[model samples]
Target: MAKLVLTRLGGTLKGRALTPNPLPRILWRSLSTEGESQDPSIDPFLHSAPEGLAFGRLTGIGRNTLKTDVIHYLEGCKLSINDVKFDYNRAYTPVGVLLQFPSRSSFDLAVRQTIRKGRLYKLEKIDRSEWDLKTSYDGKAVLLQGVPRNALQEDVERFLSGCNFDPSSFQTFVRPGFPDPIRVAIIQFPTQVDAMNAFCVKNRSFCLNNPISMRVLQ
Candidate 1:
């Protein structure tokens, strides 16, 4: 036998039916107002199914705060997510996430919004540059450090272009963290020879008003 319990809040269903096996305690907690908002606008659970999806990484988050912090942020944006996987084995700190968006537009919106949250948390693209060690570089990647937080894509491209690397073939990334002047960036070169050249000139600064250090990804 089972008992049906119904409750409504903010024009949404808030209660659940109880069965012999019962639902997980976590599902019930999600029904509560623990990390939810009374206002429907920012409520993560108030959205309709999204039409597309995108993926991003969230650092500085822990196992306990996964639902409350990361998922809550996504919900606040009105984007529906299907699943979230953590990269515990790859990253020692285990601060990674794969966000499934409803559509490309939804993903773009999430990326734009979460970039603002990067100051407080590590949020960035989970592309090959971040993961996929072998394919990420293809033995032609250079790691740059000490990049100014405000450095734009063009700024990095301009500097790398001056070094005779095809700016189109290269990709840059800045890990999310506090507003520090120095950050890490990875540049994937077109060929291993170019990577070796970039690596040969180590400890030299480029890409901003201040010089940044570069190293070949091993």
Candidate 2:
């Protein structure tokens, strides 16, 4: 397992009151229990607004930061990550397939919004602690872990229906045999077993002869 050594959360200043960046909101996923999924209704990551926060509520500064891809920027840092694993799984959510989008920023924005919507099953945040950073695989992958959410297939399909991109333009499958729309994909897994089950399902529409390769932080 990757060691989480950093304990202090950073903050930003809005005039005089110190406040946390949303990245810390993302990090709350890391602080939650391992492997055990939680109720979406109770997730702190989704409920971050202080008591009475509303969607689309943002200070000008926060708005700018809201659009910021904090996770994307952090992915480039030469840090340690430990106990990393990777496996190819069927495309389950828009983010799973969207990760392959040519524009990284757009992909990041979509993911943040989806998580904020409060319905999908989420996993731990990418291990961003110094120890997790130091142990991460170099050049193999920038995004280390993902959590699957229970996205409404209809909701996702409706979102994609409006997109200019061809539904077929993205990767489709024969191994897992996904239909016109795939209902799920691997986001992040807490263990290799879970990741593998997600990736190498024997009866699923898609099938991987070999498990998708995963890497560990050295």
Candidate 3:
């Protein structure tokens, strides 16, 4: 009976030998318990904005352009300006100005009047959804194809900065089951206007390589 018991114990040890580095069951249980303890209602990166505010992009406007000039231009238009921001690219070149208006209808009317009056700057309304980095519902993200496999995240970020936009996050992806692995990058911007400007100014080469093509995610 002792010999039979020893044989059974030896068999169990041999089976365990197949998995030499087995993890403790308690550790796995702890990990699972921690995962289950997390609350689903909380998100760390969500951004919220006030309701009734409208956003618009203005081109052909310089950073040094006097604010008083703009105010005088819009005087008697019945529209109120909440805020004005000037955005610049990595090259220190001015991209344009972003304006916040009190009402969407007033913003649209202002754009039309600017176009009809042949103002120095052109205006276009941008949806608020474009500012939400989480959803990226309005193609606030861009994808670059044919990126060199050896390229690093810093290289991509630097190149994008030169184009006048900063990336919130940069990620590289490889397709599975392909004979030769093809790598691409998905870059998310803080705002949709940046992504749109990058897309509009296409056909530019970066990394001292081929002229890469960029696609805006819809």
Across residues 1-218, which tens digit of lDDT does each residue of candidate 1 receive? 87889888889988777878865666333547676557665657666644544556666665434333556776645533234554543212344555545466766766676667665566665563443332323346676777777888788776665454666654445555456434666777777787777667645756567687775543
Segments in model 3 whose C-alpha atoms lie over 4 Å from true places:
1-136, 176-179, 202-204
Q: Which digits, one per residue and each the tens of the lDDT, describe model 2 over residues 156-178? A: 33323322222221222223333
Candidate 2 lands at a TM-score of: 0.16
lDDT of each: 0.58, 0.29, 0.60
lDDT of 2: 0.29
Model 3 is weakest, by summed lDDT over 10 consecutive residues, at 130-139
The list of candidate 2 runs beyond 4 A from truth reads 1-186, 202-218
Off by over 4 Å in 1: 1-136, 176-182
Candidate with better lDDT, 2 vs 3? 3
Q: What's the best-to-worst order under lDDT?
A: 3, 1, 2
Residue 160 displacement (Å), model 3: 1.4
The residue-by-residue lDDT of candidate 3 on 1-218, one tens digit each, is 11222225745633222324655677333535554665544644332433377877777865445344555665554543335544444322347656667776767777877877787778887775543322312346676766677888887776676465545577787643256655667777667777878767653566547455676654
* TM-score of candidate 1 on Cα atoms, chains taken together: 0.34
